[model samples]
Target: MGQKLIVGISDWKIGRGDDVLVTYALGSCIGTCLYDRTTGISGLSHIMLPDSTAIIDGHTTRMKFADTALPDMLEKMKAMGAMQGAIKAKIAGGAIMFQTSNSKFNIGQRNIEAVKAALQKLRIPIIAEDTGLNYGRTMTFWAENGAVEISSTVMGKKMI
Candidate 1:
């Protein structure tokens, strides 16, 4: 019961001790959680898109894309005394949410791929994940234990 931080779409937050991080209504978006067990420090990132390079405009929301956001989050975590080698990842969301006539419109799958690639590039292993389905999700990340709780109206709740 230390603190409850609400991470909005295209945002990230870091917490420690008994703090909890939460994000809501993840449809095509992805929620990535990174934690260092030694320090009890945790970070949660909610990204809306796969890559920022796809944006034609020079202006891009850094936290809205997996390619940019994950690295940035890791840097911030390092500033908080989290070690790169000790960090582990847990992910949730990236649901199709609705039927699409074309595969290119399936942003959920693209997001899932992008997130995995980004995490791989960061050298952070994904310990668990609950992703890729037809329903939206909400995530509650507990900093004390580095547990991510995935919740959906259709599927109830589960910890990953």
Candidate 2:
């Protein structure tokens, strides 16, 4: 698997073969991974916000929002020969790093919800996930076999 392809905040990666995609330090953000078992193609997106409609003041990156990023990742995967019908999703890292009281603006929960909504709209099934908690996470997606490995000091390691 060559060097691990890093999916930074507001970024996404897709590849086949033994490609590995990783995202580090997720806090109040969502990391969504998609894989096509039939083609051994995979994609991972690290989205920082729930939606892009709210940020209208200036030019904003489409990948920075879950609503946009998820679809973008899917399109990228399709462009790389991934069939939508054969794609399955796995998501990790939607944690409330700082618990708040007075508002419903829990970014983590919002991000998770946004990702789910987008996937649902696209008819993509999510087979596994680790989300909604108070701990940050780092995730890696293996393109060769469509496996995802998650790591976190608070929750140890898991492959889903």
Candidate 3:
């Protein structure tokens, strides 16, 4: 193993060799992993929101939104020798942590939708996903093999 890179909320990290990227406590948020098997390059993003444009004020962290962060991370990955055509995606989290009646309050579902849409627009195929439940998740992405391990208190653990 090379290193353990911790991807915090509203952030992203790129890793290679035997490095592992991990993000914790995903509640109404999403953790998306992009991997290029040929190059053994992997990137993980912990996105807090669906879109930055939805914010009325421009004072927002670009990495906090799926719409902006994925592209930015992808660009950085390419710089590190990740080919766009060979990249595949795996996603987890987007849990509905709260009980809500209004659709507007269902941020988990909205985040999942936004992440899917963003990946589609970027022409990245999503290979697997575990999403849209009521439990929070912790995601661990292995750069050496492009394996995503999802763990939760309610749900045990699984690899995607």
Which candidate number would show the highest lDDT if scored against the true structure? 1
RMSD of each: 1.0, 1.3, 1.0
Q: What's the lDDT for all of these models?
A: 0.94, 0.87, 0.93
**What lDDT tens digits, residue by residue, belong to model 3 across residues 1-160?**
4999999999999999999999998999999999999998999999999989869887778999999999999999999889899999999888888888877889998899999999999999999999987999999999999989999997789889
Q: Give every collision pair in model 3.
A: none
- Models ranked on lDDT: 1, 3, 2
Using all chains and alpha carbons, the TM-scores for the candidates as numbered come to 0.97, 0.95, 0.97
TM-score of 3: 0.97
Colliding residue pairs in candidate 2:
none
**Candidate 2 accuracy as lDDT:** 0.87
Cα deviation of 87 in candidate 1 (Å)?
0.6
What 10-residue stretch in candidate 3 is worst by lDDT? 52-61
Stretches of candidate 1 off by over 4 Å are: none
Which runs in model 3 stand beyond 4 Å of their true positions?
A: none
For model 2, how does the per-residue alpha-carbon lDDT over 1-160 read when each residue is reduced to its tens digit?
A: 3557998898888877888889998888888889899998888999998888978776878989988888888988888888999999999878888878944768788888899999999899999999988898999888888888889987889898
Q: Distance (Å) between predicted and true CA of 155, model 2?
A: 1.7
For model 2, the stretches where C-alpha displacement exceeds 4 angstroms are none
